[model samples]
Target chain A: MLLPHWLFSDRAGLVLLAVLAVLGVGVPILNLWVPPDHPLYLSAYTVTVLGKYLCYALLAVSIDLVWGYMGILTLGHAAFFALGGYCLGMYLMRQIGARGVYGDPVLPDFMVFLNWSELPWYWHGFDHFGFAMLMVLVIPGLLAFVFGWFAFRSRVSGVYLSIITQALTYALMLAFFRNEMGFGGNNGLTDFKDLLGFSLQADGTRVVLFILSALALAGGYLLCRWLVSTRMGRVLVAIRDSEDRARFLGYRVERVKALVFTLSAMLAGVAGALYVPQVGIINPGEFAPLNSIEAVIWVAVGGRGTLVGAVIGAVLVNYAKTWLTGALPEVWLFALGGLFVTVTVLLPYGLIGLLQRREKAA
Target chain B: MSELVSELDAAGLHTPIEPVDATHGILLYLEEVTVSFDGFKAIDNLSLYIGDGELRCIIGPNGAGKTTMMDIITGKTKPDTGRVFFGQTIDLLKLDEPSIARIGIGRKFQRPTVIEPLTVLENLELAMSGAQRLDRLITARLTGEERDQIHAVLDQIGLTEHGGRLAGILAHGQKQWLEIGMLLMQKPRLLLVDEPVAGMTPAEMERTAELLRSLAGSHSVVVVEHDMGFVRSIADQVTVLHQGRVLAEGRLEDLQVDPMVIEVYLGAGDAYH
Candidate 1:
């Protein structure tokens, strides 16, 4: 029951954080170096699952920054994630070249098989990893900034803001599902070949991608921690507790909300970017509003306002989903719904919240 | 950005100082300020000033615009017309609520606004943190110095014993004091506290009045209170507002005898007057 004192002490805390960061880097490398059949080997399947979990943690951290701190509950964060994934996926698709099932050198397999003449106008320059990476961040950041600027300035909040956010994602999903829109319609962009220069299917590449994902998680966590620790962080907490009081104190409440919202969206985008390469697919299903709702559930299950809790919740919930879906596929939706109700009703802080309470009591 | 009239120190009646000054720092100022809501004048041509480090009481009837005046000064609601200033340099009308706050203006609503889910200590910490605009950068561990400040503020507010307790669990008076403690952490040069004794027992009222009086040396406090006895205990000067204007201004005794104040509040030859 005792967490290491280093986990809580300041100097020791940083040491522990460093250790955790090292372990984060270690996991993917461990998977790569140790033979797959070795007793300690986490297996490709395990690495993929855990890698995906780390990505989810990034998404949860993003949600926590807005919903937990700034008091802006976004139901559309998954859309940002999907946009990032699509951007990365586009690059991967470009790398496929003449290797696609349709054997087209320039067009992606979907476009070629569909007998399309060329790459869509919006798909330009995705062959460069740098441009794709830039798109991964910029696209989501811009969308969040514009949406948040309008919503926060208008004072849309609480349930209304959450509803509007959900509506936004749903709209994106519908648009992406349309075939003529050039996003591959219902099938989405797939059949990726490489990233930068590495073959996407190589285990070495997968392990490196996993390491990158872990590094991103650690970096995102540190960044969020730094933000909340600053004077600006306290202001976000204050805004979460009371908006009008914060506004009265002379904080540009709308600007603060917009900034936090956009930052959160970017984090989600990074998560999505990492997710795409590891999963080897990006689809319109990624933009499904329900996926975003699940992200919220992850935050709730872990702990609503606690960032670590959000991460923990995402891992725990998704891990359980993997097991439950495999074991009882027919009832998985019921289990998921039941889990939400049970967590929201009984364990409002989810598992992490419960642990925090116990720690406080101790 | 709207044009900000630097009328805060335009009268040159106030001298600039910290904590407390020679009654001239102009901690809070309003000149020809008018606040109208939907064609109805809530505060009309209101003009008032609270000197630096002065514990001034604003006593008025129900519709006296006392709360609205605080709103204007804190930049919660802009005046229909007029100048509002914090110190000699800053035009409050030019700022929004958060900017006014960063400029060291603190306001406590009549109701306690501490987050109930948070402990008293946590509430104070959140208040000091203000509003963070970044998400990915807000999760750093609390520093020792920040912890020390929270402890000091807790002790100063007499809530050291209750720091671990939830703010919602505190009595009304204690909650009020906790909010005041929260405002104190910002080390605000000026504090606008509305009705610090509204729902308190007499003992609580007395304690609160004592608390507000104690804050005088370190901060300029403008307390909007209807409790005359409480005002008498804390007010160095009292201003009575009516129909959105200053009806009377002076020491409590002087206002008690003002004919115009009597006419507005007491009516002619009232037994209380």
Candidate 2:
């Protein structure tokens, strides 16, 4: 297929693609082909964790699409991410059919535990993989469209928009925590068996999930890059810089914003859908405002407007988080806080920006 | 109001607007308009008109409602009373800023606002009148004809060599000229220019004056300028606004000597020379 010239011209994007290609090919080989006793063997735990990082990276890119390029600092993207996960989790719950502690074929363990007579109306169609996949995109997209339509139309922007987004996720977190909300309550959806007949616990399934995540991250990156490269992308940047100027130029500012916001939310949804199976659970904790803020920190630390920077930042920060949380559990939050403050005060443009500046200087 | 609705219905019935009804020779009309902010009237019962393809200059002291009048004409501010019309048929009051701009009225702000992060060429391309639909914008590529049009505008603005440069890096005068170039890309029949030469060097001001003069025959240009020399160089007819009303309207030479014009300027400690 023919690609636009701008896509090919992005050197950082090409580098990112090459790296994902290497991971896509290399991780599977090391995990499945290499002998388990060998020094080079990649463990399943490591594979699952790496897969989770790729999901986070995709989420970061989604945040960057709106915050970095469009100047909308979304603080509630985790809500979309959690909502997507819940949609897929519902399907996974149905996949548990007759295998739960209560052995209820029609309803999930939580619903059975709660004495529900039948599956809720909303969960009726999640059994089919295709429908679940469609919901992964649609649920988040519909929420974003409705939210953005009202917010952008009323011109709620800047820090106010960010605050409302945070409130949105916080509200979701509260609602999902309720035992009567039809989801798994505070514990969220878990105890999944398989997806599309492939056992999620099997090493081959794990490897495939990781590969899919890498692919999704790559796809998400390209979609965002393509969007920012087009004339519409310029319009987004124009809106970011001076909204009044864009309006005066005859562009429908609110429509453009709502469209991009919906697209970004859908992308975040894809990331979350891929996340649940690898992690073995989806919980209300994923809807925390802190998770959304952490995603923003990743974008800021990587480079705000650069798509590659989001990926790089997500992986790097999460790697540090893994190490810190494991080594000194109490210090992890402090370390994360320190890192954000340091990045904000010293490195405004982020790691990618610093690299670019050095290249210019050279 | 009924006429306004019928005009809108007629506009909806046809994709292309029947050329703005300038048959009576007036291209813009602001009749008995009033605007208030916090119980203070900014534009108090004002009426103004511009002839078809005419270049008009409006000069006034600070807080004399010069900018407010432009706001009303461009749909940025709605009057509490009275009607604003684009030619004889189109009611300007009913439209939003983007819709007003689409219907051949372009505005240049006082601060020379351009998308600083974009290249000069990109800025002009964005301001072009067509291809603003969401689908078109998503897949938009610069066609050969469009590129040629952008190049023509670059030359017109005397920024042909600077087309590839970021707009933010351009000098203040160049940024101003680039904004004017953006307005030109809109193909507006009426241009509302607010202080086009505020901080321009004499040479830059002379060029801007020439550009505005050249645009007069094909476009009705309403310039609100504070600089008397720049106004004198470009305007054939001038309107003096004081306390939100027309103090005087005539040739600059005639208005300069008017007792009321001098008193308004002098009382406000403003040097009109």
Candidate 3:
């Protein structure tokens, strides 16, 4: 039996998500079996591309929480993601001890080369993966809380709020890029030997990382889905439409905005932590303003208010980037810029939104 | 008449508002209230009291500070200097807008400000109760009791048959009634309605006056209106505001003949007849 329509009324959506997940998990296995010299043996590169896209999807979901629902368009999302990655990078560097080019057992090679005798006090407990993960979450959460507390309490919204967010990320980028900041200067931490005591180069480890990425994406989507379906979600929409009316209706509007913004930052942090391991690099470049803008474009091009659309947009955009960068490397940035303008001007509702419109009309 | 209907629809209509027995007890008490806007005293040294469940009409020409006075009471505008009390013990000055709303005080603006895009039923549903927290919002599924309360409000507002229709599509008179229905769902201890019949048809005006009269038994209502005939039909007492101060106060019949009231009305009495 084909099953009742209600039983699988959203069948197309379910099938699409399932197909993406299968493709995600299948790439690492293919990489293990295929020879490196064959034209079809591009599984390793595929894994790297998809893993990075999953990280972007996670960040996009975080942005949707604030901008799509709570009406907070944070341009500081890259800061939170960088903070999480830096935390993980700290742990990875500690594992390199004597193996580093400087061959200092008690210190990171950079510290040894720089002739630093001791680690910074903040870098103390990062040697443990558990503590590093905790730091990843806490560092971003605290920054978001403090930033939101001051900005929201002032009742800032609209363009003013967006400017402040941009300034926040810009400030962090400058701070992280400083040579004396002990965050690997501009280069950041890289060249990981192992994570959880498993060799990162092993196929089994790669497969496990791919599975984790899929799990993270699914979890992020579900969390956002639950949030936007609630009464709080309705209140958020109300705030977006008419803030003054929401206030008169008995909502503590500022508090609601702050709460959602902080939660969004924490989610971005987790995505950053995941991105560093799979990509095998973490740098101050991750905090660039353009990266944050790219995230907004992802959400906008996918369908701003739709949760699943963000993930689909992230994957599709990155997949297109892989093909274009290899074939038309010189014009890739132009194509990306042109695509954004086209989507904004003619496809404001995006692919998923267009589908929804068709469904409604039909 | 169409203008009146458009105005009525803008203001949102209501149920048969009944008066409470406490109408003679103690209604609204404001002491030494002062509000300023742009260095101009909107309400200067204003103090007023209303009896419980009483229907009182406030009349003032433009710039009389009538709207400012309502703003202070409903927590929209805070006074630079003054104290406001709800019932016997509630200190209204310290409460924010949502807190003030929770304490059984409802204010209807002169313009119909109902949630426009919601279905009539959904609008009523939103107004049925208050959710104090986001968790409450998450768990707020409509129960059978809530459904019954919503249906009763619809019945009283004469929108029972139009529940499924979008509130945005309602006729002017019907929209006004829907807004009134929203306030009714709160079952407020006191109701403040501004310009209740400004552009309403003769039929809508009569029905509204009748509705206010019916509401007089269970709830205390203070209506600010420019329509003397509408006020004469419903107001038990009248207060006249002028230049940000109370100029006169008494029964509608008494104010109708007062020289000060006549001056404020400014040859507009011919229309009332």
Candidate 4:
């Protein structure tokens, strides 16, 4: 929606914007205005599901920024996502104030339960929305910068980087699980009550958040579009295809990879921050290696390089997962694993490739 | 080490402000450069020099360290012991691969790499990003002059018609030419070309020679080729390597008849044409 005119002129881009606009506006009306007993009434649960998908869409776009565009297939991207969620979660926990069972003003209930006398220094400023927002962007951005700085400068690439990223998230998961780590033990941060003083239980606030998630998804898509349109984006693609050739052409390949990597992490951070409020909890479970792997599969199932394909992949896969877990229950993981295998073999470009083929056939 | 070629420059016409002027007339210098992969020395105590705007061709039988030597100069392979310099001020060993290119030495690989997914036009665009890339990434659209420059290179490489086509779909020879054209787009002061005409047809070889020759007065070029006919066609001075050291250095005709060169290069078969 914020795109400059010349950049926003693509027909597919326009269609995506239209779909997002409709969803952003219509979903709120359906959730808030229509009475629940009506046939076309949107359920609150459906609103939450759509909001979760939007956040995942943002995560998928973030992953695509590096994996699809630059070919850095990270398996630890969920680490950044979980970190961002924890940051916002800390702020929400602070907002809980004296209402907790432990009734400690500064320490979260978990810290009080652990007999911690004071707020940890790292957890100090997250109570402020401004500081929390900054942390949402910076912590993941800084970690990615440091990680990518070492990895890319050393020219570690392909599967090696992927392994390193997996190790990164797995390490984060273990550290967060420790009771001494001060991030709420294995349960992580939860029991959020409000955001900016609006009741988390309020349907009005839920509707607004759902709308905001849609807006963010649109913004992320356009941001990626702008990036890939730039000369830097072309340089990334060149690096992806041939790093040595791009290096010989004097691209400062490490810097390019680091820039995209850090930015991708920040975007994932935003998604995780958005994700926590709607889901009503953010746990160490979000940092699971399986979650990151699932995100990669979503991008693959959508289309590796296409930004729109990532959004489609995330929504469709999650929708399928949600539907399957409720209906068949036991077969979700097998279905997901099978989906990944099948996509790799038959639908190499995922659903987007299939659509393009159908369009040509038409 | 290269023979003094100041006389060649005094007769040549080129950019008024040349990238190489001092440094004792050498554009590139490698002294006592040694590199080992495992215990085997791929480049052993080798020293070489290339004069500015001099189209020097290096020819050696297999494993003469030709590719490895290019690697050392371009900062891909670090040497165990050596002083490598570009012009005089820039130390080639100290800078990374991209910086070597930024300071005006572009290299072509042994195998062609034209970034198959990118179009010929995009390949040129990316090559243009070697210098001042941050600014280009933000505000640089090809100025009319810059677009014209790409057009001119496209015409030179005879791929003007295929600028929009992805390089993957190009003919094998065209891919080679596209990579060369990509190097050309950077407008590097020196270009290290590796086996440029290896699999080219005779006509393509002839045109490539013409292209290389036309580039000599403005750009220093180091061409390493195995094709004796191609080397003879475009070499200004030939450097022959045998066992990671210079075996012969002179005009191709003179080196071809050198009995020492014949014994080292031909190996009793007299197979080299």
On TM-score, the leading prediction is 2
Clashing pairs in 4: none
* Model 3 lDDT per residue over A1-362, tens place: 58533224445446655866786656765777778877666565567667778888888888888887777787779889999899998998888768888888868877776789999898899899999999888999889988887897677889899888898888888888886888887888887888888877776676677767777777777677777656677677768766755665656677777788878888899999888888888988988888888788788788877777777777787777779999999987898788789888988877788888899999
Candidate order, TM-score descending: 2, 4, 3, 1
Off by over 4 Å in 4: A1-9, B1-19, B129-132, B267-272
* Model 1 C-alpha lDDT per residue in residues B144-182, reported as the tens digit of each score: 988888898888788889999988899988999998998
**Relative to the unseen true structure, what is the C-alpha lDDT of residue A114 in candidate 3, on a scale of 0 to 100?**
72
Q: B1-273 in candidate 2: lDDT tens per residue?
A: 777766864433222345688989999999998999999899988899999999999999899999889888876788999899998888887777777888888999999999999999999999998856677897777889888889998999999999999999999999999999999898899999999999899999999999999999899999999898889999989998888888889998887778888888734564556
Deviation in Å, model 2, residue B7 alpha carbon? 13
Runs in model 1 with CA error above 4 Å?
A1-46, A112-122, A356-362, B1-29, B49-54, B85-90, B114-175, B181-189, B201-204, B214-220, B242-273
What lDDT is reached at residue A165 by model 4?
A: 97
Q: Of 1 and 4, which scores higher on lDDT?
A: 4
Model 3 spans > 4 angstroms off:
A1-16, A34-42, A320-345, B1-24, B59-63, B109-125, B128-130, B161-179, B194-214, B224-236, B251-273
* DockQ of every candidate structure: 0.35, 0.80, 0.35, 0.60
The candidate that wins on DockQ is: 2
The iRMS of the candidates, in order, is: 3.9, 0.9, 2.1, 1.3
DockQ of 1: 0.35
